[model samples]
Target: MSAVIALRAPLDEDLTAFVQSLRSLGVAHRVAEQGNEQVLWVPDEQVAAQVRELYARAPQGDPGLQPAHTSAQRARPGFLAQAKHSPLTLLVLALTLLVALLTWGGDNYDAGRWLSFVDFHIDGQYIYFGSFAQVIDSGQWWRLLTPMLLHFGLLHLAMNSLWYWELGRRIEARQGALMLLLLTLWFGLAANVAQYVYGGPALFGGLSGVLYGLLGHCWLFQWLAPNAAYRLPRGVLVSMLIWLLICMTGVFELLQFGAIANAAHVGGLIAGCLTGLLGGLLARRLQRR
Candidate 1:
């Protein structure tokens, strides 16, 4: 089972006290030692967030931290309630769905061009792509990040949205919506630019790159902190990396998987790992202090 680090106390005394309070509150947790600190791990992201909140408000193990009854612990929220906690994640999903509908899951070329990495127009029996100079002259810079909003088919949309929902909300809840947006844009831009260089002026759209980015971030972050919010299942990490390698082997195109964005996947993963390293170091520093 994947567990999250809910508390990282430098002193064993603090860990013991907090563990006692958490136990009284009936929160399922485990304690592990990481270098000079004692890290408390919990089952899920919501529980971790709640534990952090209560601990922040009353670090001395007050009644607030240890509620009146064990049942006072918040039950997991349904989809709507969870969406409220991560509005930006929900909003991005909504936008992607809207784009999918507008472009008929990427078959509508005219509509797709508006959001592709470069401007284009459909002519009789052929599509014309704009030159980089033309795109630059038009001052339509948003194109770089918008391709991620496009989806090529129902299955593609569903798969990407499901993964985004799974990975995006975790980070949003743990960090915040603003951080999530920044990271999304960072991943999206990197993915788009890499695909642009790889395939040049082609219509490629999907959340696959961003999905890899999130997976990469979570993989590295979990290694650094062992936080539940960032913990990815072991099989999941290996499976994705294996899939990426398979895609790079040109088997997908041969099998008519509609031209895999291999470069985008690699680029986003690299960006996410770097991002994860930076974020992990900062978080580790905060925990030590």
Candidate 2:
């Protein structure tokens, strides 16, 4: 439970240098404490204790070194683990469950009438609009946001909500809840608008587009915010790219998958990727200044 604290030298607060120095101390594990601080845990033996004392004798101003008893802290799940607990995920799952209940409860469900009724159509176009656009032009601009609340079927609701539940946890953990909420709305609305422009007035309703947007956001974040440690790893990016390619192969259409709007997928992805790049650059610039 003895954690090694960083003793930064005067004018030598480089995080990389500090970490390298810690590595030289033969510490096997490390964790960030805050900006410019870290805690390194080492076996508490006489030799290691001597090494710690010697390292603490740097000529720079006295930076305190304390043995933090982490037995209690390490015994329980950390913040990230607790934040991502299944109950939080269940909240999103429950929301989708409610939507599915309503969709299935309707009498007209099998007739395809109920499904078509909720779908968004661009006026005079073959492409589907995001439910947002239809709601907006129909003088229910408020519905632009609420239409995302609607789900057509159990599978549809389950897929979207699962994505929201899983990815939403990671996004919230990295960017905080407020940023995740804003990004959800931004990607959802922007992609829907993009679909209307590109798909030429087709009624579309689904969260798949927003899922694609989140995928793009994840990728772009890796590129733009590499050092932020919040982006997806390379393996995830490769797998997602493969998934997108497969989706675009038209197999779903050939199989008669009804109302899967790939247009919204493409549109939302493009918008979110661009926005993620912008956000990363902005964050980097702010860090520099």
The Cα local distance difference test for each model comes to 0.83, 0.56
- What's each prediction's clash count? 4, 7
Please write out the lDDT profile of model 1 over residues 146-262, one tens digit for every residue: 999999889989999999998999999778899899999999989989999888888788889998998888888767766656766789899999999999999978988679888
**lDDT (tens digit, per residue) of candidate 2 on 150-191:** 566667776777666656666666666677767777767765
TM-score (C-alpha) between model 2 and the true structure: 0.61
Q: Model 1: which ten-residue window has the lowest total lDDT?
A: 67-76
In terms of TM-score, how similar is model 1 to the real structure?
0.76
Candidate that would win on TM-score:
1
Give the RMSD in angstroms, all C-alphas superposed, for model 2. Answer: 9.1
Candidate 1 at residue 89, lDDT?
95
In model 1, the clashing pairs are: 4-227, 4-228, 5-227, 5-228
TM-scores of the models, in the given order? 0.76, 0.61
